[model samples]
Target: MASVREIKRHIKSVSNIKKITKTMQMVAGAKMQKTLSALLASRPYAQLAWNLLLNLAPKTERELHPLLQIRGIRNSLLVVITSDRGLCGAFNMNVIGEALRQIKDKETHFLITVGKKGRDFFIRRGYKVIAEFTGLGAPAPFISITPISQIIIDEFIKGNVDEVKLVYSDYVSNVIQRPTTIQLLPFQQEQPEEPFLAQFIYEPSPSEVIENLLVRIIEYKIYAAILESQASEFSARMMAMKNATENAENLIQSLILSYNKARQEGITKELTELSTTKAVIESLKK
Candidate 1:
């Protein structure tokens, strides 16, 4: 049992912590709303781009586009996206763990880490990190992620890496964020269920149009993945802070109960001592 003064101090400290966590929860909620809007807005565009790729890819030769050219697995490049800060539960760890599983079987692998957490984690373990990007703002601008995508694109085109993959957290809902791994290169696409009988004429040529669309698709894929990750990070943080605040509140209640019990016991003991002394004095007088 702690002293009354000590218990009071603990209560105050926990109250302060609760205030901080509450503030963080509100901030994360606001950020999550903003990022979620951006994420939702981009989904349609990303899906249409993939559909276009599926429709057009079969009409062209594999060697027609550099991005579509698949090679034997030699060296692989992994782009891992994580949050820069902690206190978000297992958000960063989940993505990092998924990335580790992705590279476990690879003989030659390089990393392009998008956040300080992922970059530091791989660097400390002596993983080959060809590029590192950090300090990406919430609701990250597509332009900021372009350079990161361009690096992997250039590397793949140069035959430095045979395949490129991305590991990130997918935004499922406010309560659930799943670690997801996706291959970005050499542009894998599934066959459409129905064959396209409609023939649309390309403006210049099919190959040239596909070449340009392929780059845009790849860039957009990377951008969309970043958006998804940002949304997930914000969502995870909001829920984590909410939980912390609730836990703090519960702890404060328990501490206050203990403090009152201790104070009541002290007061009762003092009253008992006073009554005992008065009775003794009365007996002596009699």
Candidate 2:
């Protein structure tokens, strides 16, 4: 049994920890709301672009565009996005695991990583980390992704790399984030499953339009992945903090129960001692 002093000290420490976790939960929840809004707003645009590409790219000389052309997946670049700071449970690890599993046996692999966690993990493992960027915001800016996307695009055009794939977490809900991987560059749509594919018309030349569209499409894909990862980060953090807060509350309740039992035991001990002394005094007087 712990002394009351020791127990009190533990309770105080737990209380402080509870405060910190609760504060973090609130902050994460706030950030999650904003991220969710940003991601949701962008979804329509992304979907529309995907649909447009489906409708347009098949009819034109989309093969001329490097981004749209399918190539052998020989020397590939994997872009892995993870959180800079982690208290978000398995969020970062999930992405890292998926990415590592993907490129572990490849003869030659180039990695472009976003976030401190991804860069640190692969670099330590002796992986070839070509470029890394950290300190990206929760809802990362398009400008932040522009350079990263351009580098991959240029590398592909130069035939330095064949295919590029992205690994991140998909934000399903506050309580659920799933590890997701999507191919970025060298995209070949599996033919749109819609009747509207036949009713498409291209302005100017098909080649020119597809050439312009291909760049935008690649940029859009990169942007979408970043947005998804941002939302997932916040969602994971919020969920983790909420769980911590709940666990803290449960512990506090258990501790309070123990504290009450201890106080009752202490009071009972003193009462028993007092009664024994009073009976002895009465017997002496008699």
Judged by lDDT, which candidate is best? Answer: 1
Lowest summed lDDT window (length 10), candidate 1: 100-109
> How high is the CA lDDT of each candidate model?
0.90, 0.81
Residue by residue across 66-134, what tens digits does model 1's lDDT show? Answer: 888889989999999998898899999999999999896545999999999999999999999999999
**Each candidate's TM vs. the true structure?**
0.92, 0.86
* lDDT (10s digit) by residue, model 2, range 1-286: 7766667787888888889988887888788788778767877877877777677756766567777777776798999988898998899999999998889554578999998999999999888898999987877766777788789889998888898888988877777888888888787666877868256556787677767766777777777777778778877877788888888888888887788788788999999999999999999999
Candidate 1 lDDT for residue 148: 89
Candidate 1 — which pairs collide?
A: none
Where model 1 places Cα greater than 4 Å from the true spot, the runs are 105-107, 192-204
Task: Name the best candidate (by TM-score).
Answer: 1
